[model samples]
Target: MALVFVALRVLLGGFFALTGAAKLWPLSAPESEQMKALFVQFAEVFPLKLFGYQPDPMNYQTTVGWLELLAGLLMALGPPILQEISNLFLTLLMMGAIFTLACLKECLSTCIPAIICLGLLRLLDICQSLVQTKKVGRYCRKKSVLKKPWEQRVSSCQL
Candidate 1:
């Protein structure tokens, strides 16, 4: 189960990292124009307006791209606690993306990538919780066994 989580983390991390970099492509690059156009189109569905001030579409796109890139890297290489936090950020980003696609009346096929990413994130979360719970339960049971006078007191925790 832990191996599964690592594999999922790498998959999700690599995927988002590549996508985030794509969104932040160089100004003269063709991909840059496409990403900018995408944000403009999505803004029509939900103007990204918070309060009374509206942010520039390109800025919003850049901010999101930066976040995705940072969070993806953290998810891949950070400590366990940081990994969880990064996962939370990524989960929110994916949710927003799916909402955007839905607002645009996109077909199911078009939304599949975001949906799949969201699912994998969810599965990773569940697996993490289960692993933690299992460890705690196992520790308690082992502690009880080790309390006997005849048995050696040994502690082993291997992930």
Candidate 2:
């Protein structure tokens, strides 16, 4: 189970990190030019507005890039509390992406990746909660006066 979470962390973290790096472009990456062109086209098409103001296209993209890179790294390597926070941040980002694509009437395929990422985030959260709470198959077996010998289970399992 631990190995599974480790694999998920690597896969999701690497995905967001690489995608973010692609957007920011280190100037040496082969696809930097293409990514820039793509972002320009995206801004032209999407026209995202914040506080009723549209931001500069490159700046907006850069902000998102840095966010993804930092949050993804934290999600992968941070302490448990930070991991949970990063996961929530990334989940919100993915939700925004899906909403943008949907509002633009983009093809269904464009939204699929965001949907998959959302699913993975949910899976990680659920798995982490179950592990932390020790609730799967965990039960309170304290003896009860009125309960049958075979049916004394309760909800206070903490051992």
Candidate 3:
């Protein structure tokens, strides 16, 4: 189980880290415009439509890159608590991205990968929780068993 978890973490974490890092690079005007167009496509279905905020494509990409990089780092660290938090955040981001793209009727090939990553992250979180719950149950059972003899001895003495 631990090995499985580790492998999942490495694969998911490395992918996000690489993708995020790539977005941090400066692009030419044409590239920037292309990216902005993509962002506009994504924002078309976003729930924040009421805000009337049109995000700059380059800025949005950079911000998303940073988020992915941070989430990837946290997952790689293998801290259950942090992983859960990062997983939830990433899941929501991916869902929103998918929804926006779908709404715009834009077939972005990259969204598939994002969805896959989200699934993997969520799986890892569930696995981590199961492992934690198992450990806690085992500890509690051991403690209860160990206390039974002491309680019996005290009761007999009182009698």
lDDT of 1 by residue, 63-141 (tens): 8889888889888888889889988999998898899899898999989999999999988888888888998988787
Q: State the lDDT of candidate 2 residue by residue for 29-54, as single tens digits.
A: 55776766656655654534544666
Per-residue alpha-carbon lDDT of model 3 for 88-159, expressed as tens digits? Answer: 877777787777767766666856876787688778878888888999988787544355888989988999
**TM-score of structure candidate 1:** 0.80
What TM-score does candidate 3 reach? 0.77
C-alpha positional error of residue 73 in candidate 1 after TM-score superposition, expressed in Å: 0.7
Q: Estimate each model's TM-score.
A: 0.80, 0.73, 0.77
lDDT of 2 at 53: 60
Which candidate's lDDT is highest?
1
Backbone N/Cα/C clashes per model: 0, 0, 0
Q: In candidate 2, where is summed lDDT lowest over 10 consecutive residues?
A: 150-159
- Sorted on TM-score, best first, the list reads 1, 3, 2
**What C-alpha lDDT do the candidate models reach, one value each?**
0.82, 0.78, 0.75
